[model samples]
Target: MKRLILVTLTLICAAFTLHAQDTTQQIVPGRVNSASNQTRPYVIMISIDGFRYDYAEKYHAENLLRLSGAGVRALAMQPAFPSLTFPNHYSIITGLYPAHHGLVDNTFYDRKRKETYRVGDTVTVPDGSWYGGTPLWVLAEKQKMVSASYFWVGSEAAIQNIRPTYYFKYHEKTSNDQRIQQVVNWLKMPEETRPHLITFYFPEVDHAGHSFGPESEQVRAAVLQVDSAIGKMADAVSKLNLPVSFVIVSDHGMTNVDTQHTLSLPDTSIVKALKVAPGGEKVLLYGNNEEEISTAYKFLKQNENHYTAYLKQETPVRWHYGQEDIYNRIGDIILVAEPGYAFSFSKRAMHVGHHGFDNNLTDMNAIFMAWGPAFKENTRIATFENVNVYPLVARILGLDITQPIDGKLEVLESILK
Candidate 1:
């Protein structure tokens, strides 16, 4: 009897030890529990500023060609309204529209503060006031996953006191090579601590596109240089031999603007009738009396040949434009120039290329490409909006973003192996 009892005790002890070992093995080190227990895939999101779909299609960029050859490609990424950098980039990261995200415009005057907020300016980062929604990096951190960014708008913002695990101060002259090196070094860290989500931004293409038209050789050279840098990044990731995915996207494409098609603000009588000052491509008109507002609206509308005008609440619903919440951020009357024509604040100034047009313009459509683990090869998806990108990224990282997003988890059925 004593021997049988001892044997039973020994077997129970062994079973418990085996169970513990199984549990330990199941717990992936540094892995957070998302909705799905599947191991999170590493993701690198690279933004080539002002990269147009046609640029990649027409240009002889061997490196970018290699990426497209290896992974899934979207013909064009439709950007949200204004089609500017800050709002579009923010939408890509947050999966929300500018109206919902509260970025409203690239440069919006604040009536209460009596100041102008430029999206690129770090000084304008309010005390949790600048950003309207949670960025993906912050959302990832909340789920106990690590994220890093090189330089993205609102990354410096003190909102929620959340900063990327690693970040560099935004510098206009930061070389493409330097940015690539920084990302590679971050990835070289041990698997347990390396960033699960990484973002790298290249601004030279946009700068060149703005300086010279999108079709100019200068922009083409910038695109090739950025493409080469992307190749270096992919090479480094390939060396890791881990199942990682890379995505290359852009904020907005560029359009050529001719001097003959320019409209000067000073030349318009509508400018003299406004209460508040105007800036950038859009004009802001403020009025205390109903008559002033009505007069301003009629003048701008009657001369539709000279301008594309929108009454404060009457802008197109498709663009998600002119919500009451964003009215203060927007002008009482908003104006956009027709294609080939750009609104110029000064007649003396000269800019060959520009964005910030309606979303319908093909030149305003951006680029999107994804390659590597769990992605389909040589596949092209139809048109997708910028907001859809965030959920796709979240799904890749195995994160559950609890907040409602404007974007949906797109049909990546072809990409999944």
Candidate 2:
């Protein structure tokens, strides 16, 4: 009797382990004989940081404008609330709100890890624990498809113990042309080893926009430079003659920020009671207890003219923020600056241009343009949010997603052929 009971327990444990492994292996991809069909569809998604929707027209980006005219274009692309770079970029890949993906802001305090994640901090940026949602690269890997990334917000991290087949460490010294050439080299690989999906990131536009105002000549020149690079890259891709598509997008837009249009907390007492996460147009404040939370909320709310304050639960429904289990990642009190204004703990000069403002503002809009075999030609459509992009990319890759995602493929289905 004792031996039978032990044997039964051992069988049950083995069965449970097998079930877990089977669940993980469920995302199998159908093998296609690469030799037979030399024209399997491929995708390249590029991100130009701070590329405002109007820049292509205002700056006369001939290359980008032409691509938009030839392919499908959107009036603009709406970024998620707080309109920062890291959050929205991750959101586009994962199809989850920043609140849901656990990248609440460019800079956030993670209570679980007892660390703060800053865009400039090398260690925090690559730590996978801070990321929640599985990025597109990981999804592609699960489906047995090869993917590569020049640079992406979460690509450096290994989410769910998986990373892209090919990705470089985040380095600022790499040139745009060099990055494009590297991707092209990947494309030149044998059909079996070639990447099915590749991502490219450019930060020059955002850098110029922040250093000089969005309307300044510096930004205009930057736009033109990136446009020329895109033109060259497009030519290179065309030479490959693969069934490829290019999806161009921006993480967010930049707006002019004046040093004079700054809001400083009037009540010093609120600071003593609250822990603040600074930077960006919006400021998030946290407290140790409910009493402190209420105190901070009341103080920020009192100055309604300068900014709008809300409890995490009361944040605007449309923003879709703070809807996840990681409530502490967002904090208790949220303060969104008024248009043309920014929030700062100290009254000082701000960068000439800034983002992270309310998503509804016209200046906070991003850009979207796509050209390829999978898209319609000479098409124009109304604006859509960045979250919807994940589903579109998944569909183009012929992958199924069962995770909780905020994106809907139907929103952008009209432009697909």
TM-scores of the candidates are 0.85, 0.89
- Evaluated at residue 199, the lDDT of candidate 2 is 90
Query: Over all chains combined, what TM-score does candidate 1 have?
Result: 0.85
- Score each candidate by Cα lDDT: 0.70, 0.78
The reply for model 2, stretches above 4 Å from the true place, is 1-39, 323-327, 345-348
The digit string of per-residue lDDT tens for model 2 on 1-417 reads 000001111111111111111111012233322442234578999999899989999999999989879999999999998798889999999998888888898776766665667665556667787898879988877777778887788877778877777777665655778877887898998776677889988878888887687999999999999999999899899999888899999988888866676776565776556666765477767677888788767766776766788898998888888655353688677778876777654434566688888899998899999999999999999999999999998888887786979899999988899
Candidate 2's error at 196, in angstroms? Answer: 0.9
lDDT of 1 by residue, 100-219 (tens): 787776666656665655543435643347677788888877787767787676665655677666765555455666667777776776655567888878887887877778888998
**Colliding residue pairs in candidate 2:** none
lDDT of 2 at 215: 93
Strongest candidate by TM-score: 2
